[model samples]
Target: MTHAHFAPGRRTFLASMGAAAALLPFAGAGRAEGTSTTRRYVGLYFNGAWDVLLGPDPRDPAQSYDGIDLGTDALAAAYRDPIPVMMAGQEVLWGPTMASLAPHADVLTLFRGVNMNTVAHPAGRAYVNTFIPPSGVVPKGDSMGTRMAAAGAYGDLILPNVSIGMPTFNLVFPPDVTGVRLDRATEMTDLLEPLGDMPLSEATLAALRMAQDEVEGCVHEQYGRPPVEDLQIARDRMRQLLSNGYGESFDLAADADLKARYGITNPGASNDPAVIAATVWRLLETGLSRTITAQLQTGLDTHGPEWATQQPQRQQAGFDALAALLTDLRQDDPNLDDTTVVVFSEFARTPKINGRGGRDHHFAGSVLVFGGGLRRGVCGATLEQTLGLAAIDVATGQPDPAGRVLLPEDIGATLAHAAGLSHDPFRTDPLLDWIA
Candidate 1:
């Protein structure tokens, strides 16, 4: 495989996070109120560099090239021409593979010209996750999902951050906010189940619980109560997980109708894009987590002839799965409005295909955001000549001589702001115009 490599241990979760205090709503500070009232976030990431021209960004073949260079002898081409679609009354070009998403354009918030600033897979992936560049392949700070889990309106949910086959990091948040990592959806169901037969009868369990509560009460009365009372909360949450009906609710095989909708033939083990989409929906619907991140597609680091044939197909399948997930969310009124979804890849492919009939990594990339009361429109642009990122007016997302370049940090800040967080953790202002 001619793919980028990274340190394998980066995916390991922190096992010693101390229990976190009960979550409190983050202050909105003095930021202007946009229309977003969402408290939950869902991230769907493609594991490798993707060819944006076949999805969110494309050039028309029939039109004049003008200053842009198509390379006189390039061998591969997009399987189909770009399709022009009107989004928010503006004509936008959609690549052939993104057809499934055309119908949902009204809610789409496409951010183009995002400068990933690195072609290396590890750096780019880490950049997207935390909006902070890594230090020699080691991720810095907390992942966006972890921050959300710590600051969002988590209420009484036990698992605030659930990451399935996704790279999640936590360097600063409370230990309780650390992600509950799992390889697949089945693991979640298993984790919530009781172990073997009950070792103690109900009477004994009740007596033990009462005894602990009394001991904690006495400690609290003497110590003026631990500020967050987090340890006790953590204990209660663990008991709730073991005793609740969550085992049955999360059993993927129990819902035949849901399996059919997502085209899941093998429920627990499958990693199909559609199956991942369904898993996201299940997590959200059950109100089990405040933030969820999952890898929906992989093997996109195409550096050979397979680029033309395999890349576009994989991209399309992922888009189709996303569209299906949206449709399912629409079935329940207000579901879409309350949840925010983001789709992105580590980076983008080079504009010109290489001699090997494939493309290499590029710095400029695109991201798709929708739901959560966000407006539907494009937020930035790339230069036509080199397909490189262009500076844009942050307030309006338009090209200007004095404009600044867009970065993943801007997106992170925007999302944090929408979640009513007052702090500028990403050290950038949110794209105010992107708000509904």
Candidate 2:
């Protein structure tokens, strides 16, 4: 019923848990790597179902001039004449809002015919992130980000996994391997500089630190040996995070040009997806985190008259942010070749527009991937009449009557492999064709 229901002070709870874990004797054994040369994974989730016909459709002009339209002015205007763009030297029809991504087409790959099975928000979100379909609404295993953080090599990193404005079920991960959630980048600044308002005098600061240390020691004594060591490790980690200058990555005000490029401005009424994307980029670039997950602006559910105006704007904002992020990754990071970015919706919209000029939920959807040596091009197809999924040979990424339909599980498996993680734990097969 409220934002609290979805977020529920998750950031604070995680911070506290990390501090408690520091008190344990073996907590240091789970620390992440101080320096990692391996690749990073970033996930951008577009909440709600996105309309595939609005983006790229395989419909014939004879069957439907403009695929399926809900009759909204916005949809009609945008979808009436879909334009074809060359991506990775292949002709592909792109949605009006996707123009920003055209320049980076050489590295972009689109996957259609993704079967998500469910339209329910909770289940869909969980399934897409974790690759395991929800039994009744709860996730069965760790998400890809959590799994990547759990890898032994990343244990010493300050924050191996970072999630912002996204639904993350970390209970499935090991207690010390959990990710940190922040509602906004500003909150991250606050966490790193909790004493910003306190006295700056050396004596005053020292007294405050001593008081805090005394309290921590008292708590450790009360909790006994195991907890005491974990608490101590957590305290040392917090100090390392502050001293190592990792929090500086969250300072968006330093570079005005960079902020403008990512559409980040001073705080306003709502959080911008561009700023979130930029934050993820900075985290990876600075080695503050190895895996990051963020949600773009919601409201893609276009269930009524709102679809006429709201849906187009929402789609455009998401695409523009993504385009900027990709550009920065290529131009800014020296290790760009080692990073992978994935963007996808839980499912797609219905083929036929409903009476209210809106689309209902559909089982089939699409996904976009770039960087990390993935093959650049389009894969799979959809039928004209029903806009249903078309099976594709997993090995070749080509359409086949008897081929397997691409599913979220396959995407998850592919990502796991890209991160050099074991897919056997998840019991899913990777789409090897996408890997380069």
Candidate 3:
């Protein structure tokens, strides 16, 4: 489905990257009614096509395959090897890089054979995030983060949706729900902190508020337009932000234990995997945002000899950071009890090793959805030899001839359903069996 462009008359203020983290205030008449879920969402995007053989859809190195490269023949590395792990009585092979995450096998669920439908980087990323097959290179729908905000899941949160080094699109969702972009997690402090100390005294502050209210009254009397209303909303929200002392809560570096756990030596200058994950945790723990999408790893598009080395190292580092995030969440505040983390790559690498000793892009993908009330198990699979997608029963997550191939829309719909969105614009239903 396509969303109409933002009307010329509507005034929507988006947060500028590298600038102050300003937010569009909730200008609508409060939030839409009937939001049924309190669960928050975290999206960890592994940019570039990840090699599934080294991640969520690993294959045994000792196995003989007709067309698949187990990476054991010529391209051999400790990280490229797969290790068997049992989850819910099922034996699954996870890349050795998943060692840190394997311990949490009981709380996470794996989805394989996800048909990304596109091998292009931009199109695949857009499709996965927006749940609409891109119209060429453009996204046709709002991101799940924006949709969750529009669904009123964030209530009156000032910064409801946050995108950190991840693409977030908004088509029809309210402008207030647009994801605020940030390069580093510590920038949140910059967004919330006042430019300088409150130079105005209480009397002056009250006077300024009165003057703005008077001007707003005059503007409303002369021009009853949406833009004027939106401006007033922004003003009121900024005032609320300054008065609430929200910036103080986002001082992540001040937390000695958090710094030690995430290895955040300098939060302001660091955008490492640990820092990004820590920022996500802080945002949710402080109730500053409901939905967050962050880029967890990069450089996975290995079509050269480095695939045997760099690919696994990158994947392992990313997984290690994620495992730490989960542990921190569960240990400190039980964030995992009420929060769901969705990890995805645009697509998986080709099954066979190329002439360069690397893998090319493959449309069949895998996903990891865990935390909240999700059951721990594996769903869907790839063909034994070719590594192509296998049709799976959506309910049972098992391969079946009569079942349909899982699409990005199904994942999107499931996220929306879990978030308690009343609408279902996706073409398919959610995987109900995966939910608790």
Candidate 4:
């Protein structure tokens, strides 16, 4: 009998994690259409800085470094005394808050050393999206969205990429070759006024369909068999939708009850990052959107008791919501044994509690990688209580292959890989070497 979390291995075993009530049933396209379609990768790139020590840490102090007393009660209880140095004490690394996501850890791979330098959210956001640090005006360059859009020439009929939430997705590629941008709203009136076209109303719709046929005509010539007319039809309909407008991701209001459960006072209205995350997943499952960018709330730079007591709970809520989403995804598509999900942040909190009772941002951080197909257990070093310059071999932390500290660019690279794109898509900075 499989419980809601489908437990096995080291997933969701920690005591600190919590479970979320299932929100809505999975939405499928149903048994309508055509031939077979192969599975493609779907990814989520969470933007922000999430503290490692506050969550899951997997390093054994005794063998890891000298005079290191820092360790979690979980790690301490699980690993015991004389914990082997550099040895992974657990098969999967997660906090009790993430229990709902544990069952799908097998294909997951966590990169603990996702440290970055920028504490400024905007700059860090740029660095996280594109593998380039924020510079001047354009700050960073080609993010995953642009990379996939350019590669749209390849792949199946579906747009190579699409996004929700983050503006970074909008800036990823050159506009000409970009894939369909699924705005939550579109209107036929919006199209004509912008283009100053003579064609009005129904005429405009007809013209758009004709253009789609032309695009498909060019595409069909490449194949020997009759063109996948079915795909061309889809393209035509999508073009029509674009012309008609107002087809942005599903309306949160339509599901007032579900929206309330998912905690949607409105988009970005709820301070709970979980609600935004759930909305992102809803879009992805419906195929209305391809990728989801989950960003946690700002103002977490807690420098007082308020931080310790308040911030942790917010993160817990975010994690719990994320966990529940994962549980739901699994229940719906256990076949998506390959479904991959990610949680990341700009940088880590300070290694030690500051005089202000709050933790300042730090040079090191970590990542939580789950779902899809892969290996588990800790990949990077878990501070084992000791951190900062005090970390034994900071040069090669357990999370870092050789204790190599990381930058924001590494996260973009890692996300590109996790989403099944080549890390060198844009030949930007090198990606973190976690998966391959």
Candidate 5:
């Protein structure tokens, strides 16, 4: 409903723009040559910490049942239903909630050793989006979405980055390059048709433009460049919005079967996970956006006694929505061959169940990456004793006794690299195995 987060304070937004201009090379860098691919990205954020034990784990018998001790009998019962999936000739176990994604095992790769570094929700989410470890203060860096949009591939796009039902502070890029957030898919049409039935004649439109231009000239001369620049950017955005045929992407009335497949039974509530996934796929399919970030309506923060009962439902909803999205991409989306999907949570739930029968936040998390020629099979390892992430060799994406823990920065850098963006500015090393 409220889109206030999309509209940052004018002063703050302008200051970010100025700062971006000062670091032109880093912030505005183009994609590397010889890496010019039409690859697009979709970032799916599962808000609230997810429990990794609910999914696949490293095959260490000693560590295989780490979380069971803290769970109730009901929670322990859930583990007995894990589905075995064969990936790259090796069998991997997927929890019952993830059974929907089992059919696509060869295309999906799960990572087990991601360290978010913080247990706090806001900081964890920020770290995943901005790829910069938060120091209690908001990081000045832009999100991977913003950076990918700023790259040359989507430079001329009307709305290169779109955030749907997601709280984002993607401020690293220039003001014009920042992402636009929509509450729902139909909002795309609302934005494009704000005038409704109040159509103006050509003469009236021309007169209004002339008046606006004259006033803009006077403001430029009287005030300063910042205000004028901001006004111009706003005007340009409006023009681009009107010229781009983005509304077509939201025209789902004729595709009843498609809607059903995506679980969009009610068109009014687009916040449904199925609808959210459908909206993002439509945006990508229609070339309306080069990068999309969407938040699922299902919550993963099961911090109460009902966690065992609630978690499976939430995870199943997420997995089903994602599986449906992938189905459509593989069967319908024209950009399927050039797209990559990354699904992750801010953090993971603790291995030990808390007093309330629910899990608290943990420092480690897991991620699922599919499409874009990525290799199948799991990367990184979880420790057998603590159920924590083990150190990994970035180059080999394997466990090494002397390696360091894999952090959110490494995952972010890997995503940037997969999207063909330059990762020289990021301090984290990319997981080379993620790239095909």
Candidate 6:
């Protein structure tokens, strides 16, 4: 059933993130596609533990996984491009549908060999999102987006950090700054500061003007740039634009065919990859948000029979959905031609397929990057033949004699680099090369 809106002060969630509602007038995708200056950097978090492999491809040809010695590296090279880095370590997760990204690889940047101290899913996600976790009353740092907004005080068009789906503490940034969570990801804007009652008396109008002047003055003094109350208010208008079906740009129900292509039942969940992709694409088209993440969860750890039996089906569905979503994004929003869409997970499955016909979690898994001026083609080493992880040299996509284990910092640094932020705004470590 459709929920009217999240209870006040509770999580706000976006409903009908499927193709069915996208065609509706207020999905927001139809909002003017502004110039590149309007759409800046967007960060995405692939929530949940996702397995990179297990795609929709139908070919039975065997392939290398996470630098395993599958013995078919030579033949596999013919079907799958050789990734020299996988041999040295830092291979990402992959399944049959991995090739779906082949068409858009040129405009993307890839990362491998990243580490998150713990293998636990939630802990790892928090670390990836905010670079630290909460310790009881000791509050964690603010999210990257909050810092961006604070820094871009001029409203001079810096990218907005956006996270879609779920109420995540990761969205919370520093200095007691935190984002309001929406139970519905689509109606996300409602969670922000609300406008006062309309058609106010002269006294109320004077108050608004005073408030605006104060806000403008503060931003101007701090940013050393001219005031932008106009732009900020217009952008702030986004919060209310999603009421009812008025902002149906994200609704896909308008297109019966597209809706069918995505999925109707449990359409936008960790179980449904396409739904995640499509929802994210809609956000991008609005030209109102930057740094949007569409998380795909479930199926990475196979501890029981149900997971073992259902893993393949889930993988296939997710992969197919992902492919469809990417294809649609390219078709719908030409603006994303320079946008980078990444598919990531904590780690890869073990080299050896377990007795249950499932793979266990391994340190080295694969991550995919699409768009944003990529180098194109595959890098790193060829597929593996058996059950041992390989090494990688980030500098040359060759083997590192000491053996390289993917470090989480690499991915984190790469993301910061992509969005033009300092991994350690405090200048902590060397920069990562995922963007370069």
lDDT agreement with native, every candidate: 0.72, 0.68, 0.72, 0.45, 0.67, 0.43
Task: Rank all candidate structures by their lDDT, best first, as comma-separated numbers.
Answer: 3, 1, 2, 5, 4, 6
Off by over 4 Å in 2: 1-36, 56-67, 70-80, 171-176, 195-197, 200-233, 243-254, 332-336
Tens digits of per-residue lDDT, candidate 4, 1-436, equal 2112211111211100111111112112221133122222333444445555555443333354442333333232422322111213455435443444555454455666555556676766666555566674244455544443342232332333444344433232323223333222211113223233464678876786577566533323443333434445445434433544333344445666555555556644544555555565654565543444445444555655555555555556666666656655666666454455656666666655567666667656666656433344454454454554222232233543344554445555555454444555345443333433
Error of 5 at 130 (Å): 1.1
Clashes of each: 0, 22, 1, 28, 1, 84
- Model 4 lowest lDDT segment of ten: 12-21
lDDT tens digits by residue: candidate 5, 163-253: 7766555444555556677666566667676464788888987797677555533333433433445454455556666767766667666
- Candidate 6, 1-436: lDDT as tens digits: 2212111232222121111211112211222233133333333444444433343111123443443422223223332322222211333333443555544444444554444445566556555544443343332454444433222222322123445553334222221112323334544333432345454677975686567445533333544554354334433443234332334555554546656766645533333556555555555555545445545545556633444345544554555566666676667545354455566665555545556645566554455556643343233432344323346666554457565644555554444444444555323343343334
The alpha-carbon lDDT assigned to residue 224 of candidate 5 equals 42
Ranking by TM-score: 3, 1, 5, 2, 6, 4
Cα lDDT tens digits, model 2, 1-436, are: 1011122243354344354443323321343343234567778888887776666443433344444653534454654445678976778887776778878777777878888888888888888777767776776666656665654355466666777776655543444545677776556766676456653777876786677556544444645643544454455666666677766577787778768898776633236777777777787777667778888668899878677677667887888888888887887554345667788887888877778877889888888888755677877666555677788787767788899788877777776665555566557777787777
| Angstrom error at residue 353, model 3 | 1.7
| Whole-model lDDT, model 2 | 0.68
Model 3 / residue 67 / CA error / Å: 1.1
Cα RMSDs, all models = 5.9, 5.0, 4.9, 13.7, 4.9, 10.7
In model 4, the Cα lDDT at residue 203 comes to 80
Model 5: which ten-residue window has the lowest total lDDT?
1-10
Q: Against the hidden true structure, what lDDT does model 3 obtain? A: 0.72
